[model samples]
Target: MTSARIALVTGANQGLGRGLVEGLAARLGPDDLVLLTGRNAERVAGAVAHVAADPATRSRVAGRVLDVTDADAVARLAAELHDQYGGVDFVVSNASAMLTPDRSQSAQADDFIDVANGGALAVLRSFAPVLRAGGRLLVVASSLGTLGHLDPRLQPLFDGASLDEVEKAVESWRTALHTGTAEELGWPRWINVPSKVAQVAAVRAVAAERRDTDLPADRLIACVCPGLIDTALSRPWFTDFSGAQTPAQAATAVLDLLLTERVDPATYGELVRFGRVLDWHDGTPPQLPDGLLVN
Candidate 1:
């Protein structure tokens, strides 16, 4: 008998992460396994129970405690997957930290760069070796982080012809933020936008790196935007917003990318929003009501 396909999702206790796990559990083959991971053990356990409650998905769902920002924790998980399952077939880097109004500029920068950007990189880096050939990697990003929000001068760097250049561009933004020159450097003051931008760029870089190496040509690595879901992270702005989507609705978009029978190479490094490939590079910035969302 063939071994079961394995999928791992970070921050799977609640919100979009939970929805993604649930959707996968319901749709994946009966022999497949879905590992729902979170930073809190109790929360992860509860989420596992919730997903496992359904008889159809019960045997395929399990939970793990993982803090994506912690290198040791990530390494441990990767090692376990290697030993027990050979490798994972799908990895979803869904964990993220958002900036709150009370945070100082420095604090916000740390949360965005260190927590959000850094955490996603850690997940991808540590798990890369353990990702099965022809596997798929999905990084959850935001539309707010599109290059359209950046100054034209900086756009070239993020959209550079090579991964190395994109990495340098992301570093430049971080340096500007640390030195209090972000505004002068033409970076948005909003923490989420740049952080998500960096993530989207990182996806491109990873795909490029793998393409130039021995990894399978069919490996799918891409960033996806859930598009303003009404979750804890977006509650402040989403409560009064008319266009907010339920977490389940957002999860369907991600699930389609992960479980589809055919993998489209064109989407390997693009940001997909609402089932469409958003031209974030040249698209117009989204405008929301004042105070409805912070910059």
Candidate 2:
């Protein structure tokens, strides 16, 4: 019998993360392993129960309490994954947070600090050692990060901004709004650049670094936007009019990409939407018509 294949997903208790777990379990066989994790122990347990209750998924389910913001915990989890499973086939970074709802009214830097920089980066670094060749790392990113989607005046946000920079900017924006100094009254609905760029860079780095490793094929890493998915993380403005997909539908697309078997280096760091790959600049995958879902 073949050993079980292992996949780890952060923030898997709900939303897209939850959907990805379900989709993968539906498609993959009994010998596959899926680890559902989140910051809340109860949510993690509930997610595990949800998967285990499924007759199809019961045999392959596992659970972990992982808050991606904890750097030491991430490193420890890496060690545990390596020791227990030998290696992992996939690592999905789905955790996220906001410094404040009103991007121009609050000064809470904790949100960006935890979500963009520490959380996403922790996901990458923690699993680097355990992500074997041929594995895939998919970061649930946003189209807002695309340099093109941003107003030309906002280019600086995407150009040289790091995760820390994002935190600072959000904090600045929040303060401005609170102080009634900004013209805008809403949160700056932009993608976090550090998280997005890190996903792409991490994949490339892993592939290049492991080019000569005894592994069979290079790992695939990608940043994807599931469009205006109906999730708690999204703004009401998005759900109000944007084309939105259910978490289940979005998960299906993500799983399809992860289980494709063919790992394309070009797909690394690119945005996958509507089951198609797109260039980051244009926000649409290649070979599709204009005004498609990606754009």
TM-score of 1: 0.87
Candidate maximizing TM-score: 1
Candidate 1 lDDT over 1-295, as tens digits, reads: 2388899999889999999998888888888999999888999999999888977573388898888878778988888888898988888999977655444545556656765677777777778777777678888988766788666766777674454565566677878877888877777666566677778877777777775442344667788988888887776444476887888888998998887666776676778886677775755435533452222
In order, the Cα lDDT scores of the candidates are 0.76, 0.64
**Residue runs of model 2 more than 4 Å from their true location after superposition:** 98-108, 149-218, 239-242, 283-295
Checking candidate 2 for backbone clashes, the offending pairs are 103-174, 104-173, 104-174, 104-177, 105-174, 105-178, 106-174, 277-285, 278-284, 278-285
Candidate 2 per-residue lDDT, tens place, 1-295, comes to 2267788888888888888888777777777888888889998899888877876564377788987878899889888878887878888888876422344212434465466546666776678667776788877776544545444454464444454454455456545545654335332333243335434434434445544552346666667677767777664334263567889977877887788778665675466665566654553211322221210
C-alpha RMSD of each candidate structure in angstroms = 2.9, 6.8
Using lDDT as the measure, the top candidate is: 1
The local lDDT score (0 to 100) that residue 35 gets in candidate 1 is 95
